[model samples]
Target: MTGLLALAAFEQPMKRFAVLLGIGSTVCVVQGWTLAAMLFSLPFCVIWAYCGWLRTEPQLKWLNLMFAALYIYGLARHIWWTN
Candidate 1:
């Protein structure tokens, strides 16, 4: 689920690059490499989400929020609880 969430983030021109990184991050997350995933995907996800908000696209807005939440949860889980 987290992987899929991460996979949803992308933008044109950089879409292909972002997708590849997103997939790698998703794989890291799925493999219990939460730290690596967070370090890798957090920036891209933030940028993606912010870009979504900058546009008039309603779907991207909500979808990015959802993905952001999932990323946050994943980060928090690793930070405060998974320890």
Candidate 2:
């Protein structure tokens, strides 16, 4: 995710906006704001993945794939953590 963000920061014009949305969504989660974080985080995640898929570098492609796996793992962990 960080790798994707870094790449987006370099290449994408909307990177900053996406990052801001992520931060806001994180804050919402921390503040116990209902399901809004999940919704907000969705776009950031999608954009990250999209940007990663669009990357031309082989190393970045691998990194993106790893990041995506880790992201899914984190989501699964969160479900268990909350339960």
Candidate 3:
């Protein structure tokens, strides 16, 4: 019962996260950060591709880490570019 409820609670957030990442990836691509965009987009792509497999895949976890690191790097580049 509790476990079911926990699963239910997690489901929506994961769905929303997947959608958000998808949109973010699209934005990156549109902005012409091709390589950075691909790096930024990979986790969401994996999320879309694998769906329920995220829980079991260490590579997906590492992909998310790479996404985060790339996102931070992109932010720094943007700030540097604007200045």
Candidate 4:
């Protein structure tokens, strides 16, 4: 009971945080902070992917998963190959 209550309490702030990160990621893109934006958006992509899976939304699931894979690959290449 207490655990469920705690989880419920924690859920909203995390959702809000994820949303802010998404918005901030877009703003980063607009401001030409491409790397920062991608970094911020990775979590958003992952979260949405999970949500899509839980809700059985195939389109959303696949799209987000694809983006997440691409973002991860790009980030890895940038971090490893560039150095």
Give the winner by TM-score: 4
Every model's TM-score = 0.56, 0.52, 0.49, 0.77
Candidate 2: worst-modelled 10 consecutive residues by lDDT = 3-12
Q: List the candidate 1 regions with Cα displacement exceeding 4 Å.
A: 1-20, 26-32
* Residue 79 of model 4, lDDT score: 89
Error of 1 at 9 (Å): 20
Q: Which stretches of candidate 2 lie over 4 Å from their true place?
A: 1-11, 56-83
What TM-score, to 2 decimals, does candidate 4 have?
Answer: 0.77
lDDT of 2 at 21: 71
RMSD to the hidden true structure, all candidates: 8.5, 7.2, 6.0, 4.1
lDDT of 3 by residue, 5-75 (tens): 45554656766787887787688788886655655565565453343344455676566666656766766
Q: Which stretches of candidate 4 lie over 4 Å from their true place?
A: 1-14
The number of residue pairs in model 2 that clash at the backbone is 0
Over 1-83, each residue of candidate 1 has an lDDT whose tens digit, in order, gives 34434534444645555677789888987999867887668666665665565554668767767777787787788778757
Cα-based RMSD of candidate 2:
7.2
Name the better of 1 and 4 by TM-score: 4
* lDDT to native, each model: 0.68, 0.65, 0.62, 0.80
Residue pairs clashing, model 1: none
* TM-score for candidate 1: 0.56
Candidate 3: clashing pairs of residues: none
lDDT of 2 by residue, 35-72 (tens): 56765665666556566566655565566456556556
In model 1, what is the error at residue 83, expressed in angstroms?
4.2
